[model samples]
Target: MWQDFGDYILSEAGDDPVKIAEIGVGKFDKISEILSEKKNITVLKTDIHPKDSTVIKDDVTNPNLELYKDVDIIYSIRPPSELQPHLINLAEKINSQLIIKPLTNEDLNTGRVKMKLKNYKKASFYILR
Candidate 1:
């Protein structure tokens, strides 16, 4: 499923260099690392609690716009139900595409307009364009 998510990001990013943020990345940086290896993608991993030097410390509820200025894509892996709106808000404020990969069978709790459920390569996720 993570590979499916990564492939979706790569496809959305194309061959052009793009900035992408992974919200609430926590200790699992596999997807971010994979995306960063694409050579055209710059992945920024963020979390409220930094587990390593690579994870930036930031609160999704009130994200630091300065850190996410002009990002192309914002994605979260199994983000908490309560923080879905915050991710949506940040994506809207930055005018970036938002992708959320919630746990299997877990319904999205966000009520943001224009959110669409997408099944990319067996990866079931929500996208806000």
Candidate 2:
């Protein structure tokens, strides 16, 4: 499942050099690690409570817009329900593609913005463009 999610993001990145941000990263970094291996993909990990020096400290509810500037894709893995809407807002404001992998069977809380449900390989997530 994790590989599938990483693969989906890689497909979006294609062969171009792109900047990607992972919001609410928490302690899990497998997806970011996978994406970072690609030379063309620049991965930025952000969380309110960063677990290490590599992960930047940022609150999704009130993110520093400068960090997301020129980012092409923003993805969050299992972000809390309350912060989902804020993710959508940030993606919209930055004009970046948004991907959210909620907990199994957990519906998104994106207000009136309807994100498309995508099934890529064994991964399932919602995408807002």
Candidate 3:
């Protein structure tokens, strides 16, 4: 799923260098590492409580716009339900595409996010264009 998601976002990126942000990245660097491999993409990892030095300290509920300026894509994997709207809000504010991969069978409460269910590989996620 991470490979497929990375491919999808890379496909959307075309040949231009796209700035992508992974919110609430947690301890997983699989997708981030993969995306960063591509010369046409730049990936930023953010979390409120960063587990490592690679992740920047930032809260999803109240994101730092300076850190996210010109971000082309914002995605969160298994983000807590409470912060769903904040992710959407930040994406909306930045006018970037938003992708939320909540845990399977989890509910998403994103007010006015206008997301559509996207089936990429075996991963099922929501996307706001």
Candidate 4:
């Protein structure tokens, strides 16, 4: 899943310097560690509860995009199922690409929105534009 997501990030925002905003980043510091290794990529971490560890504290559903106006990609791994719609909405608002690896409880099957699914060995991915 990580490799596939990295590939997608490279292909989607290869030429431009990109800002990647990760919502619901609980204990997953590995993501920041990985993205930080790449050049021209700034990863801003956010969560609902503000802590010294969290870079930004805001809810994904109604986020304050003012601080993240130029974000290029919004990445969420196992975000709450109810907040998936918020991700889709924010992606459209910012003209940014959304990468969501939903949890077991989240259902990606929302008939209102049309999304193309790419199934992988371990994780099934979707690209919502």
Measured by TM-score, the strongest candidate is 2
Which model is ahead, 3 or 4, in terms of TM-score? 3
Shift of residue 81 alpha carbon in model 4, Å: 1.1
TM-score of each: 0.95, 0.99, 0.94, 0.82
Q: Which residue pairs does candidate 4 place in steric collision?
A: none
Off by over 4 Å in 3: none
Q: What global local distance difference test value does model 4 have?
A: 0.74
Q: Over the stretch 1-129, how does candidate 3's per-residue lDDT look in tens digits?
A: 778877777776678978999999888878788788889888889999999999999998878899999899988889998999899889989999998888988888987656899898877889988
Name the weakest run of 10 consecutive residues (lDDT summed) in model 1.
Answer: 107-116
Candidate 1 residue-wise lDDT, 1-129, digit = tens: 889888898899999879999999888888888898888888888899999888999999988899998699999999999998888889989999999999999988887465788999878899988
- TM-score order of candidates, best first? 2, 1, 3, 4
How many backbone clashes can be found in candidate 4? 0
Candidate 1 residue runs with Cα over 4 Å from true position: 112-114
Q: Residue 115 CA error for candidate 1 (Å)?
A: 1.5
* Candidate 1 structure lDDT: 0.89
- lDDT string for model 2 (4-122, tens) is 99999999999999999999889899999999999999999999999999999999889999999899999999998999999999999999999999999999999989999999999
**Which candidate model has the greater TM-score, 2 or 4?**
2
| Candidate with more favorable, higher TM-score: 1 or 2 | 2
lDDT of 2 at 42: 94
List, residue by residue over 1-129, the lDDT tens digit for candidate 4. Answer: 666556665566675688988888887766666777778888888889755655688887798888678998888888776778888887888888788777654568434776667565455667776
